[model samples]
Target: MESSSALALSQLPYYIYPTIPNTNKNYPFWPAGKRRSSQLPTRLHCNKMFVPGFGEASPEAKAAKNLHNFFTYIAVKIVAAQLESYNPEAYEELMEFVGRHPLNDGDKFCATMFRESSRHKNLALRIMEVRSSYCQNDFEWDNLKSLAFKMVTESNTRLMRDYISETSRAETEK
Candidate 1:
């Protein structure tokens, strides 16, 4: 009879397990399946990217890489800010992308500085001010500025493409 009962239990589609009491006396008031706030997954505070040759590169090479990252980060910020006024949804998506993407120390520093300066009423003036402060020389500043412009153009293009595709899809649905 015991063997038959055991076989019957095994054949059941689902079995309910007995709930065990929480063993930790420290959190006696806490509910089951709940965790402390400190145990939760924390969001990254900054966007830091990993450059392949950064660690082993010469000082000059490292500086060049940092400059490139800084301009790229600034470009992304500029594009994101532009989108915020015209298309909030696209702006949100861009911000999410920025949040997810990895950046290096240089990029993080640029982002932090930009964030601070962006509080000013005139974004263009602040950007120029930041450029002046960071860029080593006029030629270097011009080159980096061009790179930032190129990045903004490319990002805008991609956003436009996505917007067009979405419109087309809506049209098709209609």
Candidate 2:
């Protein structure tokens, strides 16, 4: 009875994932068309791709790669900016890009600098730091000015949060 059952199970159509199909370069592996052919390897070739611990490259891997490249770009720009002479045009461009991205810390600091016109040293240092870390562009002079501006600008949320908290507390007390 066990043997019969085993045989029956074996006879049943089971799902199979073809490791590689033998067809031309363009076809769908197993010869879907005469004009088109595709190649599928039965086994993964290490020379072709090496996947270690994980089964496959995850989305996280892709993201990490992108982030790494972005940071590298920033670092190169920073070093170049610092070593080279001051250029107003480069600072402007950096500011425009930052304005578009509008990072909270970056934006706030930039705004402050623009208003106070202080912390030029801080701004320069940060510009180098940001570039060293993750900046990836041929920064413009205006953007550097903007970065300085953000350093000095007031945070809008600071006052708003305080007001809301004070009003709520008063209402509760009443």
Candidate 3:
């Protein structure tokens, strides 16, 4: 007697995404030797977890939660696929850890920013605005610099053309 939406949702893969392992702490909730465990209640609380929106939330809330989780999984999968074209190793690692794992929205944003160079600083900065919460300290600084270099040096994007020209002029003056 479930609604069509409910049926659709049931057909989609559902899993409690695991958080990436941190250097400092151990996650005790995922019982040893288990491939999947129920999602923990609060990301901060390792001990407390239950089926999301099962008993405590209203039907509307449950729908919303399901939608959010579904979309997050899709988005991460898309980004990981994009990484595969540019950096296969990074793509593999991201997929292995983040594809089915739980991460805050900020962490997802950071994952996309792992690119070697982007033509869009404004976009990158916009994503970075959320960086305060979930950046894992995993990005390579060299890649970031290379990204900036491409943005400025490439003919396509004009974000730093004037600045680069001015700097070159000053260097020549010296």
Candidate 4:
């Protein structure tokens, strides 16, 4: 049998050296007689392990999580509205995929089937209706409104100017 002590330490670069017995605290791998003024060169594994963006600590991951949460809430509302029962098996399959996959994957999956036929179009509209209900109730459409305001203010086009005037008049009347 090969003894562990016979193995060279350098071969296992990732081995935590501090765990070894009788290794004094002066340095991780310092020889007992070493008395140099300079410290031993420390090996720092600074490279972080690659984490997938779908569920990692990144901002994109956070946004994807938020989107998935919102999608789940919308789906629950759709199910409550009896729309889910109309196509029980399809709804279950979609929910299963949504639960397991990332938001971008879900979007790609939906887009691929969203316009395949009239039935798909109708289903897409129903999903949109569910999302609209959530947006209306949660007051979560502010970003879109802000974007529209930005476009209206920045554009010097005649149509935009007309829209600005019409909105301003409507606001005054209200």
Tell me each candidate's TM-score.
0.30, 0.21, 0.27, 0.30
Clashes of 3: 3
Model 4, span 41-153: residue lDDT tens? 33434344344444536665676566755664564456435646687765765556446544444345446446555655555556666655665686456785798678887
Tell me how candidate 3 scores on lDDT.
0.50
Evaluated at residue 107, the lDDT of candidate 1 is 48
Per-residue alpha-carbon lDDT of model 1 for 1-174, expressed as tens digits?
Answer: 322223333233333422333443577778757767654433333344434454677556866777666755565576567778997876675566457546455345445545543332233344445554545443365676699899999999999999999999999999
Q: Kindly list the per-residue Cα lDDT of model 2 for residues 1-174, writing each as its tens digit.
A: 322223333233445442333345543464443432223212322223333455466555865555544554455356447544685654664555455543434434345445544444455456546744454445454786797577556556677788999999999999
What are the RMSD figures for all models against the true structure?
21.1, 19.4, 26.1, 19.3
**Whole-model Cα lDDT of every candidate shown, in order:** 0.57, 0.50, 0.50, 0.56
Q: List the residue pairs that clash in candidate 1.
A: 48-103, 49-103, 49-104
Between the candidate structures 1 and 3, which one is better when assessed by TM-score? 1
- Report the candidate with higher lDDT, 1 versus 2: 1
Q: Considering summed lDDT, which 10 consecutive residues are worst modelled in model 3?
A: 39-48
Ten-residue stretch with the least lDDT total in model 1: 1-10
For candidate 3, the per-residue lDDT at 40 reads: 26
Global local distance difference test of model 2? 0.50
Which of candidates 2 and 3 reaches a greater TM-score?
3
